[model samples]
Target: MNSPIIQLEHINKQFKNKLAVSNLSLEIQPGSIVAILGPNGAGKTTTMKMLLGMSKPTSGKISVLGQSPNHQQVRQQIGVMLQDVSVIDGLTVREVIRMVHSYYRNPLPIDEIELLTGLSEIDLKRRAEKLSGGQKRSLNFALAMAGNPKLLFLDEPTVGMDSETRIHFWKQVRQLTQTGKTVLFTTHYLQEADEAADRIILFSEGRIIADGTPESLKSGLTKRILSFSAQHGMIPGESASPSDTQPDHNNANSPHIHIKAQIAMLPNVDQVEYRNGRWSLYTTDTDTLIRDVIQRQLPVRDIRIETGQLDDAYAELLATMKEEQ
Candidate 1:
């Protein structure tokens, strides 16, 4: 395997009396997309700044491309699109691109940068400072690519983009990875990371809390809910319905009084609840439970599935952290 393109050892950062990042350490494998996620003031921004050579770590070693992050050669091989996109005083977008191109020995072509960033001819002619937020971000994106860097660092890249543009941006990033470019981005959009990154690193309180693929972090920490409206049905190798279940005194006339218990007996079902004429079954093994539901030929309709999302996992992790503290 190729050695990591970036590495950090016992890294920490402090501001005045506040400890921004605490004992953070991780490595980014070459050609992989990684997302750094956390709430505000979680040290995510600070860490990225250090990696970009804009800030010095209070203590510890950081290496990018086998050399110090601040090394001139290493700086030339990386591109950055910061959260606050900057514009040159009076340069047009096209001129801004050209100026950055002059700094790199081998730069990406202007037309290709335009194609990758959705910059129009009119946009290229406009003064950089006069562009809208999204437009400025696109210009920033184009400038970052001008150097044709092997590694990219983007913070809140899609903040001001419309849905179509946001979608396009991620698609472009994915394609860039196919050519062996590595990307590291930080975003509050958990779903974006869930959909885009090959791996995810979660940070909180300036410390590493979790690091794994989206699937690995989600499994065993969250649940999936399967729901459908079902008529009384039979379970193979078991009675069609429990005959001995005592009728509840208050709900003796209600059909749902016994239905809950009957559904609870389904394979791999952990909890069953019914509301609005639909039954929701909670289970970790939705696949097994779904198969059982189908094979039994139960009279069911309006089948719906709700898998635990990254948002759910993030919340669960945060709550756990609070309880531990």
Candidate 2:
């Protein structure tokens, strides 16, 4: 296997009394697309800054392209599309692309960059400052490609893009990896990471909280949901006996206490809820739950099953981690 394209070892970054990133370590191979995920103030942007050599870590080490990220050669091989982009004055879109091209030894052709960015000929003729927000984002994407960098760092790269443009952007990003390039992107849109990344690294409280493929991370949660509806006053408790009924003095509008009392006995059930006259069962093993319900001959109707999504797992993991803290 080839060497890791990026590596961070026991990295820590502090700002005054606040710790931004703490004891973080991970590696990414070439040709991989990685998603760095975290809630606000979770140190994701800080880590990106360190990796880009825009800031120094308080301690530990970092490597990009098998050399210190601060090295000029490494910088030349890196492409950055930061959240805040600056538009050069007095430059038309074409002129801007050409100017960025001049900064690189051998850049991707302007035509290829235009195709990759969905830039039309008319857009190429417009002045940079006059472009709309989405247009500017596309230009930023174009600039990132201009150098033909081995590594691309994109921060919220699709924020302003329309759905069609957003889809096209990711399609182009995938094509970039086919050429052995690496991509590291951070986004508020978890679905993008779920659909695009080879791996996800989650951060919280200045540390790495979770790291794995999207499927693996989701598997960590009890992900299958079995739900069914029942008519009012019709109840199907997984293992409820008449004696199991109890009073819900605490919640007057809560589901029937008798039904709630028997929820604990459900097979493979992690959580159970009644909302909108539907019983939603949270479980890891939907098959077992389904079988148990069938054998019991419950009066439930409109049965449905749903697999857990990345956002579900993300929420669960962060809640769990917060509890541990």
Candidate 3:
């Protein structure tokens, strides 16, 4: 394995009265895209600022490209596209890119940068203030890439971009990684991370909640939901009594019996509904539930089980985490 391009060791950052980032540690390898995912005020932006040496860490150490973040040489090798980047309104797109390129020793060709960023239609003579939000975002990316830095920090790089432009931007990002450039970005869009990043690090309450490849994170949280529609309206209880025939009776009427057993004894159970038919019940072991229902001669329809998608896994993981908290 290659050495990590960025390493954070027991990093902690605190404001006057609150700890924005706890003792967080992370390692980002070269030539790969790593996405940092978190909700608002989760210390994601603070961590990024510390990594860029824009804010001093309250404690711990950080290294970028095997050098301290404060080192000028290391800073020169890193490109930053902050969420709140402001450009000189009077400068044109081409002028801004050229100005940024002048700071680096060997910047990429201007024509190549323009093509890679899909800024060809952006008038080179048009002032930065005249561009739309998406165009401005693309210009920011173009300026960030002008330095030809080994590592790039993009904070919500595709914010305000149209769907087509966002797709185009990811393609450009992939091209950068192909040439051994490392990308570390923060995005709220899980789908964007799924499509763009090779690895994902999820943060919550100033802590690293999860870290792995997108597929691995998804598969680890994969659940099987057995769902079907019922032909008749029958309350789904967890357990049922062998002799209990009152379908309208609330499960609270018999608190001693297991609700799961009640569900097993129901006849013609097409699906499990709870709370007066408000919510549906999904289980991993549908075979047992189905077999039990079949043995009881229940008329079930459209019973099937399959792997849940990424969105389902993501919601389940977050909900589980919230419950634990």
Candidate 4:
């Protein structure tokens, strides 16, 4: 693997009354897209600013492209899009792109920027102040690309983008990663990170609480939801009781209630909700549940098993962290 493009070791940042970041250490690999995720006041922005050299750490060392983050040589190789937009007002989009491009020895062509960023011809001519929120975000992304830097930092880069535009932006980002550019982005959109990032680092209360691929994180905190609709005579309070006059399947409390009870007893089964002839089972051991269902001859149809999602994992992860604190 290539050497890490950015590294922070035992970094700490303190304000007058609070510690914004605490002993944080991370290494970002080249050509990889890493998403920094956390709830509000989780030190996410502080960590990004420290890595970009916009804010100095109270202690410890930091490096970008194998040099001090603030080093002029390293600065030239990095592009940054901050959460707070700072482009001069009244400047045409093309002019702003050109101005930032001039600072770099090798910059992407203006036309290429427009194409890659999904900026229309009219957008290029419009003044920065006149652009809508989403348009301004697109321009911000275009400016970041102008430097043709090896590494890029985007904090909430898709803040105001519509769904279609956000999807386009991810496609462009993937193209950049293909050409060996490293990107470190922070987003409140968990699904965006889940979809776009190769790795996710979750921060909580000024520290990294979790780090892994989205699938792995989801597996850790979430369970598959197995659902099926069936008409079994299972009532809430009683076990299956088949009457002599009624068939077992027709006994309102017999088959369905029995199956529900059996499933609830299975190891690793979290919860079960049954209503209106529909059953929703939450479990980590889905295979066992399936096997038991088959072996027990539970009457079920329209079976649907949904894999765990990153959103559920994120919520559970934070909830667990809060408990630990």
TM-score, one value per model: 0.81, 0.84, 0.78, 0.84
- Ten contiguous residues minimizing lDDT sum, candidate 3: 229-238
Instruction: Please give the CA lDDT of all the candidate structures.
Output: 0.84, 0.85, 0.77, 0.83
Instruction: Rank by lDDT, highest first.
Output: 2, 1, 4, 3
Q: Which candidate model has the greater TM-score, 1 or 3? A: 1
Across residues 54-156, which tens digit of lDDT does each residue of candidate 3 receive?
A: 9989999999999988898987788888887567788887787778778888888988777765765646668887887888888889888887899999999
- Whichever of 2 and 3 has more TM-score, that candidate is 2
lDDT by residue (1-325, candidate 2, tens digit) is 8999999999999999999998989999999999999899999999999999999999999999999989999988989999986689789988988888889987999788777657788978888898888888988998998989999999989887899889888898999999999999998888999999989998888998899999899878867889987443466423433452344448544345545555556778888877765778998888988888888766678999876788998898888877887
The TM-score, computed over Cα atoms with residue i paired to residue i, of candidate 1 is 0.81
- Model 2, residue 39: distance off in Å is 0.7
RMSD of each: 6.3, 6.0, 7.6, 5.6
Candidate 1 Cα RMSD after full superposition onto the native fold (Å): 6.3
| Better structure of 3 and 4 per TM-score | 4
Which pairs of residues collide in candidate 3?
Answer: 238-259, 238-260, 239-259, 239-260, 239-261, 239-262, 240-261, 240-262, 268-298, 268-299
lDDT of 2 at 49: 91
* Candidate 2 Cα misplacement greater than 4 A, ranges: 227-280, 284-288, 299-305
lDDT of 1 by residue, 150-209 (tens): 999999898998888888888989998999999999999999999999899888999978
